[model samples]
Target: MRLAALLLCLALPVAAQSAAAPDDMARRAAAQLQQAAAGLERAGSARDRVAALTRTIRAYEAGLAAMREGLRRASARERTIRESFEVERLRLEQLIGALQSMHSSPEALLLLHPSGALGTARSGMVLSDVTPALHAEVEELRARLEELATLRALQDGAAQTLEEALRGVQEARTRLSQAISDRTELPRRVTEDPAQMRRLIESADTLEGFATSLASLPADPAAPDLPDFAAAKGDLELPVRGTVRRGFREPDAAGIRRPGLLVETAPGAVVTTPWPATIRYLGPLLDYGNVMILEPSGGYLLVFAGLDQVYGRAGDVLPAGSPIGLMPGADRAPAIPAAATEPGGQAPDETLYLELREGDAPVDPRQWFRLDED
Candidate 1:
């Protein structure tokens, strides 16, 4: 019921915009112009951010459903191909043995040494019989070899996919330590009092107002503030391996927009920082659940929200790929039907929201890092 209700609340758009539809990437390109605006602007409201996060989760759940089915089909195909290869190999061996047998026979030896014109004529008759059978064997062997080659390729592809899935899981686990270590860290720049923030939020009408207020507050002096975070832009990587369900500044169904990338991942996936930064704020922020904002560089913030649980607090300095939290339902995903499917109709079960900021200005995250293999 939780899953169903959530899906109904946030209808996912198509995974990849079609040729007929407005190019999603084109919109992304246009959105980049937001950064080019005269000065820094504020982000959207909590409700708007939450709504986008909801849609991201719905899309992810759908992808997870499709991925599970694909893995099943791939596993079955792997078995079938392995079995077929064995069968064909035996047939090929038998064909080779038959040819070898014929080569050593009296009939074949006679062709090697014909007696005269009459003997040559007799040898010709034997050769004619042997040639047809040998040709048939060779043709069959050629076909079997071709089939084996195709099957081998399929097996290699399947192995790669399986390896990718395993790697994603392992990477998530590896980040567990960083998350645990930072759990006790204090808040930076923002007040630890939720009541105070709530009071401030009620008075503030816009996200910009709230963020500005948060910034005006005293910051933790010990939080590692990198002077040269600009150098780490292209070198950064994702916290988890997943598909880009949404790009930075992509508008939602209601036209409410945020500057962030939504990664559709599997349940129980790990979440980490793309680069080293101090945790500015780590707690629930109205609609954005379990938010963790990292300041990788001076004036450049990386925001990740919608986590099941967060392991760090404000003021802690984290390394790149530091494990911070995990998504829900790792044992198994909730039975939520995917709202939108991929090109091959696969859906995933989890969502992670990522956004970048240059001071107060929002920027396109697509320019930041390359994605891992699906």
Candidate 2:
């Protein structure tokens, strides 16, 4: 009787093993599911999705392994219990039969086992009593499931927001590139004709003055200051339409006999003041067919020559872009022959000469005017 009681005590653990595996498996599955859901929520882009999915799958696979191991251990223990209780086990046999019947039916497995059959002396210590550890693990798993579900929902919403932001950035970049292309091409198309080129030059000169004035003004006091010339230097547009017939030279040939700067433009083309300036001279000079000298508000002198007509007289405060003259006859050295000359000899071509002087010395106009990339 003593040996039988000892054997029955050992068999009790084996009988309990059946419930252990499934509980462990459920716990592991729950933990993995939670981890996967958290990863998904933090994902930001396509790459993020891949990373989250990889981690999630790994967790699930680990849980699956734990579950399989638990199930295997439980099955082995159940077999042992059945074999041990084979003889003089009428009561145990009936319990095993009931257990086996319940196992066979899916619905029965879901229900808790009855307490009295487990052989516990305390009515409180019943088959229905789950181990505290198992109960805690189950609760942990349930919490994780809820967290994962919430995380997954958040991840989905974030992914959509990221996709929309990416699309908007791409569209804006495309439009900006197109605008730059159009601005670059405009100079090329209009420069072919001398008359059109002159107009473009006048516009460019006026814009350069406006940009310079803006640059002279102090930057917004509240905004951070950028490096000098960062906002102002390149902001100015090209000041002439015709190709740079002659660039800034060390011993400037286009300068007055003294030394200054000069740019040859098409004759008869309107010469607009770059800045608000007063006309100082407007008449013929030694080599300049028609000369006009301006004293600009910014303490600079601008001299224009080779004009077919003059619109502003001396003492006139000319605004920027104000038409000053028409291009000269063809006999004059043509600044833009292709643009100024007609098919027949009906009209004469003209050229423009520019000189920028600071006090008495000449500076490089190229530094101020925007040059076409050749």
TM-score versus the correct structure, for each prediction: 0.51, 0.31
Q: What tens-digit string does per-residue lDDT give for candidate 2 at 201-311?
A: 344333234223322333223322223322333343333334455555544455524233344443323345555555655665545566666655333556676665565
RMSD of each: 18.1, 29.4
Model 1, poorest ten-residue lDDT window?
35-44
Q: Which stretches of candidate 2 lie over 4 Å from their true place?
A: 1-240, 250-267, 330-349
Question: Model 1: per-residue lDDT, tens digit, 73-113?
Answer: 43344444456556555444555665666566776454553
The Cα RMSD of model 2 versus the native structure comes to 29.4
TM-score of 2: 0.31
In angstroms, give how far residue 105 of model 1 lies from its true place: 20
